[model samples]
Structure formats: C-alpha cells, structure tokens
Target chain A: MKHLIRKDFLKEGYVFATRAAEIARAAGGHTRPARLASNENPYPPSPKAVKAAADVLPPHANRYPDETNKEFIDALKKRHGDYRFVASVGMDGIIDTVIRTLIADGDQVAVATPTYSYYGLAVQAQGGTTVSVPRKADFSVDPEAFCRDAAGGTKLAFLCTPNNPTGGTTETPETIAAICENYEGILFLDCAYIEFDGTDYRPLMKRYRNLIIGRTMSKAYSLAGLRVGYAFVPEWYEPIYQRAATPPFTLNMVSQAAATAALRDTVHVKKIVSVVQEWRQRFIDECPYPVVPGGANFVMVDVAPP
Target chain B: MSPPRKADDVVTELAQKGGVIVRSCASFPPGLPDHYIRVSIGEPWENEAFIAAITDIYQP
Candidate 1:
C-alpha cells in the first residue's frame, strides 16, 4: 500500500465543545437543548443587520462574491485607520491565513498554554512546531517565559487575551510590547473577545509593526453564523499576505452586507455587551462554586467533583 | 454509602436521569482532571435545573 497522507494529520484529533443536542439525542431524551457549549452571543443580530442580509440574499446569490471585498475592507479601514486589513470567513480562517502567510515547514510558533487550542492546532496543520509556554497559575502569560521560547527558528507567536475557557485575566500591553521587542518573529494577538475585555490594542499596533491584531464579529456582535472576521496587518505585510493568500471572495455578499450593517449599529452591540457583562458578574456572584473572574461574555465556573 | 463518583458518571447520570446536559472537562488537554465539568451560564430556570440535578446526584 502506498504511504500517502501526512502521518501527523492522522495522529491529530478534532476535540471541540460537544453540542448538548448531540448528547441529548444519544441519551434519547426529549428535552429542548439549551446551547451553551460554544461561546456564542446569546442574542440574535440587530434588526438592521437582519434587514441588510435579507436585502442582499436574493439578487446576489447567483454571482461570485466580490473578490476584492472593497466595501467591507473600506469600512474596516475607517474603523482601524491607516492599518491594512483582511476580512475573511471567520476568525479561525483569519488565523489560518496568517499561519499560511508566515510559517514554512519546521518554523516555530510560540503559544501560551490553556489559551485557544486552535492556534497551536493550526500551526501544526501547516507543518510548524508549536512551542507551548505555560501561563501563570492564574492563566496570565509570563512574558519572559514566552519570549524565552521565542528564541531561534520561532517565526510566529500567538497571545489570546482574556483567553477562552479561562475567561479571566489578560496580557498587559507592556507585556505584549515586551514579547514583540524580544522575539524577532511575528506576533499574532487574537482579540476575538476584545469587546468583552475592553482593551484597545490599536495603539500598541502603531508601536510594533510585527504585531497583527485579529478580531471577529462572532462574539460580541451576535454574528457568528455570518462568519465575518477581519485582521489589522502591518502595511508592509499586507501585499505579502495578499500574495501568499487565496483570492479575496472568501466572504459571500450577504455576509459582507450584514457585517457592514452590524459595524454601523454600535448601539446594538453596546446593549448586548452591557447585558452580557452584567450577567457574567451576576453569575459569578450567585454561583456556589468558585468561578474565575471573567472579563469576557462567559464566566468559567468550576464544578465540584462528584 | 457509595464512594464519590467521577465527572463522567455525573455527566452521564445528569443526562440520562435528569434530562440535563453539561460538559465534561476531562478531554480539555494538556491534561485537566476528571473532577471538573464546565456549565455554560444560561437563563435562570435552566441554571436552576442544572443545580437541581447536581444537588440530587451529590446529595444522594
């Protein structure tokens, strides 16, 4: 038999949050499942967003989406100001694009552990080795430890602030700049939950060109189904990213329209954020078990052993 | 009295016996313990249901 597919790919496992419905169906229970597994916005998209997507659904379905994605990128530029941007399928896809653009086989990517697992997984899929640095017991990154591993062969690193699952704690801007200053490689700062954390990294982006900030409409904007994510890349790398990337039309017309409309509806997003923030605190206060001090939409509740 | 059960047993019992579903944190790697489970915060009644199920299992 011919030895074909990558051996490592065979060894890799796809482990993500299991759907409650799947478990209920398997158990033969008749309950209407409460979807709490994925960290999705609890509310639906704003009415304006719904109308925007609905308006575009029909007439544009036949044609290929705009490859350039000019209007969407233009909106992003207005928000980001001067930073070159790329909007793609989802935040995960945006990470994949960055990995594809920078990492070559055998290159190294340093990631803080108990952060988002997908960062390391994506790096591995691209044939790059992941240097997993353990965070502090409180789930905050130790800048020194992370930069120490970023020595030689390390071409990229990822920092997930208010990291997923461990919903509390964040990497300080000083720590971020330290990592960027120390590590010669590119640094990808995943801000998928930035709206919840409420820390702006755009200012830091100006100081460090090696830093790339990636965000999504998934978490705070209640547009997870739309799959619109954008990244602020250093201007110099923009052309390089474009050259190394697939042609633009990764987002469909409806998604682009919805995202543009959603971006304009800051009031709706603010309302959703306030509700989530308030409830998260209330959940922590009310929980009998210990809960992490979450800075994001979801709180990490520690359940006791049976 | 029976010895304390594991997270997997608790999760299975909750679904089968109480019609409630929650996540078992056993699979979260870099090696997490079998003692912890993750329950997403939901509506008051939904959370009350989960707490009730857990109380039933542990209290017994």
Candidate 2:
C-alpha cells in the first residue's frame, strides 16, 4: 500500500469523534439519546430567533448571504460593546484568515498541549510551526515555563479559557497580560467557553493591542448547527484581519439571525448556564470522580481507580 | 455482594431508562475503576432513578 498521507497529515491520527459516532449509531436501536459529550446546548434557540430566521430566509433566499455579514457584526458589537473590530466566519475560514493575516511562513505559534488539537493543525497548515509547552501535571500551562519558552520564532500565543477537555481556565489576568508583554507576536485568546465560565473578558480586551478573542455561537447559544463564530481583534490589527477575511457579510443567513436573536435573550442564556452549573455542582458533590468546576457549560470529570 | 457489570455496563443501563443518561469517563486512558460512573444531575425523578441503580452496586 502506498503511504499516501501528506507529511504534515502524518502526525494526525486518532479521530476519536469518528469512532464514537460509529459506536453510537450502531448502538442506536435503544431509545433516549442524551449526548453530553459535545458540550452543545441541550435546548433549542429562542422563539424570537426562530421567527427572525423564518422572516428573513424566504425573502433573502434568492441572494447569497451578505458578504460583510453586517447584521451579525452589528449585533455582536451591540452585545460586545464594539463592532468596529469583530470578525465572523466559520471556524476553519476564520482560523485561516487570522493565521494568514498575522503569521509569516515559519513564524512560531506557542500554545499549551493536551490542549485543543485544531490550533496547532491550523498553524501547521499555514506553514507555521507549533511550539508546544506541555501542560503541567495538573493540565495547565506553567506561566513561568511558557514565558521562558516564548522566545525565538514565537510570534503567536494561543490560550483557551476554561480550556477544552481539561475544563479549567487561566487563573489570573496578570499571567496572560505578562505573556502578551513578553512576546511580540499576536496573542489569540480563544474564550469560546467564556460564557460557560461565567466570566467576561470585555475589560481585558483593552489591555493589549495584540490580543484577539475567538468565540463561537455553538456552545452556549444553542446554535452550533448555524456555524456562526466571531473574533474580537485589537483595533490596530483590524485592517489586517479585514483584508485577510472573506467579503464583509459572510455569515450564514439563518445563523446570523439566530445569533442576533440569541444575543437579546440574555435571560435564556442565564437560565441555561445556571441549570448546567447547578447540575455540574450536584454531580461533583455526589460522584466519587474529580470535577474541575468553572463558568463554562461543561465540566470535565475524571474517574480514577481506587 | 455481587458487583455490577463494568462501568460501561452501567452506562448502558442508565441509557436504557428514558431521559436518563450519564457519561462513562472510563473511555479515557487509565479507565475508571470497576465501578466508577460519571452521571449528570437531572430532574428529581431522573436523579433519584440514577441513585437507586447506582447504590444497588455499592460495596459498602
């Protein structure tokens, strides 16, 4: 058999999701499917969102979605306090856009491993190298070590709060700010799960001109199927991001409608987060497993051998 | 006292009950012990049902 894999794709093995989907399908004759693994919204979008989409789709169906996706951007700015710098695209396109804008070929992307796999893969796809400073025993990036390692070719540092899989966040603002001050490259803070953590980073966005936050409408918004995500770029890099991005109005029409409606339904978001958080705490209190509690919608629970 | 089937077996059991399901963390490496189960808290009926089934196999 020819080893047809590209050299870069060689390191990509173990598609756990593919395997799990298969098993779940095979096991599906059973009734009642409760899927908690994907960290998705257990509920549907609000009635207003559903109506908004219904209102727009037929009228706008004849046209491609707004190239600027202006409606979504405007809604984001309204919720986020500034739309002048927000960029929305599906994850892959946005990731590519950001890397394309900020990284030169062979630039360094420093991220914590045992972390989200996609960040490293995206960097590699753009001909950039991933400098992984492995997480400490507790599955957290060691601040001092990451600072020490943030030298040479390292032009970007990515951090996910209430980090994926491990389900914990950076403990302090100072440490993150320090990394930005210490490194000259862009600081990409993926707070996709910030809403789940019950913490808002709106204030921190002002601290560093190089900081960019990548967020999604998936986890908390109950709109993953809609595929709307946004990045809050520091004002200075806004032009670079816009130039690298696709047309201005590019979000999926239905998704944009759903997101805008979701933004207005703050009560829904609060009720869902509170319910999930309560469930998370009760599960932790009763179960023998170790639970890392946080503001995110999902909690990563570890069950150890006695 | 007889031990229950593996944690996988218990997850299988919880899923059988309507609107009742819990995650099986044993899928990850260094899998959970013979009886460790990770169940989410749900409405009163669901939680009570989970407790009833789970407590049935506790060794103590």
Candidate 3:
C-alpha cells in the first residue's frame, strides 16, 4: 500500500476530502461546528444499541468474541431468508473480502463512475483494473451499455442504490436481469441506504445466481460508529468469502449485539427517518439550488455560486 | 463567501455598500437558476440562523 503513496503526498496533507473539509471548516469558521456531510445521520444511536454496546464496555471486556457471529447472522437470516451471511470488520472490510475472494489477479471490476471512490481504490490495490460505466445524464444506470463491455476477466459489477454524489438509483429490474444474464460476474449490489430507497431487490435473489447484496448498520440503522456490515452471498460464493475472510470472534460480538438491537428498535429508527424525510422536504422546498432527488437519509447537492 | 487564503486570491477590493455574496448554481445539474447555493437541510434552529444570515445579507 505504501507503494501507492507518493513522495509529494507528505507535502500534500491527507487528501481523503481534507481539502473540501478544510474549505468548509474555514467558511463555517468554528472549531466544533455542526456538519451534515459524509451521509451520516445527525441523530444519535438508539437506546437499545447504546445499551448493547454499554454491556460490553467494562466487565465483559476481558473476553474474546465468537468468530462466526451466529446470533446476529441468525437475526439477519430470519429477515433475509436462507443466505450465507459473513461478518467482516465493517463495510469496508466486507468490500475488501468480496473483491479478494471473487477477483483473481487482473480480473476486471466495473462500478458506476462518480459513485463511491472506495470500489475503484480497493480494486486497483489488488491489481484489478476498474472499468467505470458512467450513468445517464440523470444518473440512472444504463445496464445495457454498462455490461456490454463486461469482457476480459470482468468478475464483479458493483451497484450502489441511491448512489453517492448523484443520489440517484437504478430501479429497473429488467436491466439488472440483463446484466446478470449476460455477464458471468457477481453483481455486488451495495444497498447501504436501503431504508430510504423507493423499492427493494430482495425478492430478485431467487432469479439471479450471481447477485450478492451488502447491507450496513450505518446510515439508516444509525450504527455508524459500531462498524457492522453483512454481505449475503449466493451459496456458491459463500465458501469463497469464508476462505478469504478472517473471522475475528470478538469483533463479531460487538457488532452482533449492536446490530441485533438496531434491528429490534425499528420504531425509533423510523422516527429518525421521519425527521430526515421532513428535513428533505424542507430542503427541497427552500433550496436555493437545484437539489438532486434522493430517497435516502442524506441529499447530494452541488453549491455553484454566481 | 470565503475570504482569500493563499497569496493568489488577494482581496484588493473592499466590500462596497451594495455588495452581495451571490452563489451561482449554473454549474449544478438540472433545475436551478444561476445564483443557486446548496445548503444542508438542517435542524429548525440551524435553519433559522441560516435564514436570518441570508436575509440580513441580501435584504439589509
């Protein structure tokens, strides 16, 4: 990874959005001011999540965690049907595992451009060339043109719903089917913002054998700090993931309790959702700029001033 | 509007009486006038403060 780091990088500070933040921080002119970037929920974690985390704080701190994440996976499986659920350190790690397990060296991975930067960066780190299929003018996925070039060792195609920066979604199931049918690679549909989406793709699991879905306990669940995410791989791909993953038992314990409690406290989560929705409406109405349409908790906006 | 930080953007001209901080949104994709500024959808009090600040800046 240090090979990726450049000599001039030290001269330039950490470039993971530090410039934009510094600009915003300077404009806002406060050390500890409010921020609404990074697609985070302004609200705090739920009571159940708080208590669950609290339980492991002091007395139970001495124990190593259970490796398989049975209780949490059990809860998830109940909601999501029979799928092999593997827990990673977090969503980032899960993405890492997914790419490593599925992608052989020099395997092609395609993702939507101007979408999440992590997909490209991660793939590139593993000697895979990331082909970006740009979205339409309105930012919807063109499944035909996208999968048309799915050749030469293309192993994974990532789909981000209510996609980042654009805040648009690809809801056309027919197109998704076409992509899966034509391309032999696994479709890694990352639905981190599913709670705010206009629809669900869970039922389509039966149709596409190559489809793999990712869910996070972050935004909608408000468990960002807990760092829990799960990927439901097809039975064929399950062994592949398990083989590549480091199933740290203790990490599973923390996420298991936090995620289960988050799942249970749906009502509270809904309340926070309602508030964000209200703010969404208010933002749209009062917007001085043309706000991009999105169903998720956060809005992607461009501030162009005359 | 942000004040000049680097040496390149030295603010030579002072803010005259009718000077307005206009945010252009011509670059924003779809459905906005040229003078569009994107503000986050904030809490009520935060919204109020933003409203007050903009109102004071433009209307005053």
Candidate 4:
C-alpha cells in the first residue's frame, strides 16, 4: 500500500521545529524563549490593521470571499501601479500558482542558487525539474551565465532580489536588461524584500513584458500570520493564468480586509522599514565578523573558522 | 581550543544543554562549513543573553 504513494512525496520528510514554547516548558516553565530563526518581523501588525480584520470577523463568516480581491488589488494598484494582479494566501501560494501555470510535467525551470528552498520544493511537487545556476564565489549571480544556461528548454527563470539567506541583491536593472535581452522565458522575479532596499522596479515592468513580480504582506507589512500576497503579472500572462483555472476565492474575507487596511497605513510601514534599516546598519558596524552587504532587513555574516 | 572532529556536534550540544538556538548553516543548500552558524540578530538584551550563553559554553 505504501508503494502506491508518489515517490517524491515519500522523499520529503517533515522536519520538526525546535519550538521555543516547548523548550521553555521542558526547562520547567522558567521563561519563554525567543524564536528568531524565522525571518519574520519582530513587530506585530498595526492596531488599525488588527481592528480592520476584527471588524470583518463578525457577520462575514457566512459569506464567500471576494475572489477577485478587487479592493486589495485596487489598493496595490493605486500604490504600485495598474498591473494585472492576483492575490493568494502567501508568496508560497503565489509561487505554486505561477509554477503550475507555466510549468508542465518534466519541464525545466532555471533558478540561481543558493536562493530560497521553496522554489525547488514547489518545482519538484509539480513534477518539473530545477536547473540551478550556482552563484559566484562572492555570492553574486552571473546574469550572462544564467542567460546562456536558460537557453536550453527552460520554461521559466526565477530570480530573487535581495536574495534570502545571503542578503545580496542578485539582479540589478542593467543585469535584468541583459537577461531579458538574452533569455527567452518567463521571468518570475520574487521581490519579497523590495521595500527594505527601497528601490522600485515597477518602471522596468513596463519595458519587460516577460516579467512577473511577486510581493508579499508577510515581511514589511507585518502580516505574516495573515498569509496574504499578490503578484503583478504582465497583461499577456493574465489570459494564460485565467485559463489555468486557479482556485477561486484564494484569499478569504478577513485577510483581504486586513491586507487592504495594512496597505492604507503607509506610515506604519515606513516606520518599520526605517527601524529595520537602522538596526541593519548597527549590526554591520558593531558585529565582530565580516558581514555581507545586506540590502534586506536581515544580515548574513561570515562566521567561518577563525 | 576546539576539537578536531565535526564542529556541528558542539553546536548541537550547546542547543541541547545551554538552550541557545542558532541555525547550523549545514541546513541550507551548499551546506556551509561545519563551523558556520547562522545567528538571527535580535533585540539588545535578547542578543546579550545569546552571547552570554555562547560565551559560557565555549570560553569556559
């Protein structure tokens, strides 16, 4: 009976979390330990956003969600721009949808390692293969090398700005232009940390129709618990995504309301970003080890053997 | 000052005994060197506690 299960599913095992609460309980309930392994905002959601979610909690439990996410998407468009946007549970969900929509079984997707592990996991789940182009010794990706490799039957190329774990910006505007000019595949740019760097690539979206940018409420918006994210797909890909039959009402009622409120509260977001930047600088200046130039909220330090 | 074997064992010992929970870089792809540990920066006092715990383990 076990042999009937998918091989890939069997290969994946759930790793247990070293739950801080559990550890505290084991230590005879002395004090709660801080959980910082997850790169989440130490701050909680703004009061206004919390109230907005709370407001919708009553009376709306019976009704179906606004599947279109018009208000949330509209807010994003108003702030960002009028690109065809789709809302999902989180960046993970958005990545899943994009992978499903663009990749076929046995199709190839190009990624620049060592980036997010979720990309590989998602690709494997879809029965697609990942072609990982390793970063240079300095942890910067080579756009020319990636473009050359992606020429061979690659359906999609995934690039992360201010790459996770390493905290280095991989794709600059010039490098992106080079990839766009050379590579003939859909560009899935994960801009999950764009706000931290304070650089807007929205203008370049107009020039590169092959691009689709994924942004999330989890990081800067302090809405990680809410699980809301949106992707700005080019107009050409919108029809394909529509035909792909993404599950309707992907983002529920309360999340949409909360996300909309969070977007409106730009002051809170600005304060959070500035504070993060300040602390990031503090770590760079004060830490004993050599710290990588971090464009995101978190820093990656070199703690190799001394 | 340190053992010649895998330094990962020392990291595991610290977490199990001292309750300091930094990530072993081996968990990430390209599984960094055994000596590398990824410590997520925290608030001032919280970081102080972490540093204190590590110093207690290694410097003793």
Best by TM-score: 1
Candidate 1 per-residue lDDT over residues A7-83, each given as its tens digit = 65777565666654466678785466554556777688888989999999888899998876788888777766877
Candidate 4 ranges beyond 4 A from true positions: A13-30, B1-20, B31-35, B41-44, B47-60
CAPRI verdict (incorrect, acceptable, medium, high) for model 2: incorrect
Higher-TM-score candidate of 3 and 4: 4
Per-residue accuracy of model 2 over A1-306 as CA lDDT, tens digit each: 438855666675323333333344556653444554456677787777788888889888877777666777777777878535554655545666888876767788888655556777788777788887666666556667777776676878877776665665554677677766777777787777777665666666888787787888777777777777788878878777778775556677887787889878888887877777776676557644456554566555443322
The DockQ assigned to candidate 2 is 0.18
CA deviation > 4 Å runs, candidate 2: A1-6, A9-18, A24-29, A247-249, B1-60
For all candidates, state DockQ relative to the true structure.
0.38, 0.18, 0.12, 0.31
In terms of docking quality, model 4 is acceptable
Cα deviation of A259, candidate 3, in Å: 1.3
lDDT of 1 at A258: 91
For model 4, how does the per-residue alpha-carbon lDDT over A2-42 read when each residue is reduced to its tens digit? 89987768776433235433554475533545444466777
TM-score of chain B, per candidate?
Answer: 0.81, 0.56, 0.40, 0.65
lDDT of 3 by residue, B1-60 (tens): 642122111100001111211122232223322332333334555444443444344311
Please provide, for model 3 over A105-151, each residue's C-alpha lDDT reduced to its tens digit, 9 standing for 90 to 100.
67789886656667766776666777767777677777777777655
Global Cα lDDT for candidate 3: 0.63
Clashing pairs in 3: A65-A249, A65-A250, A66-A249, A304-B24, A305-B23, A305-B24, A306-B23, A306-B24
Displacement of the residue A13 alpha carbon in candidate 1, Å: 3.6
Of candidate 2 chain A, the 10-residue stretch with the lowest lDDT total is A13-22
Give me candidate 3's TM-score against the actual structure: 0.80
CA displacement after TM-score superposition, residue B35 of candidate 4 (Å): 4.5
**Which parts of model 3 are misplaced by more than 4 Å?**
A1-15, A24-31, A247-252, B1-60
Better of 1 and 4 by DockQ: 1
Q: Which of candidates 2 and 3 is the stronger one according to lDDT?
A: 2
Model 3 chain A scores worst on lDDT over the 10 consecutive residues at: A10-19
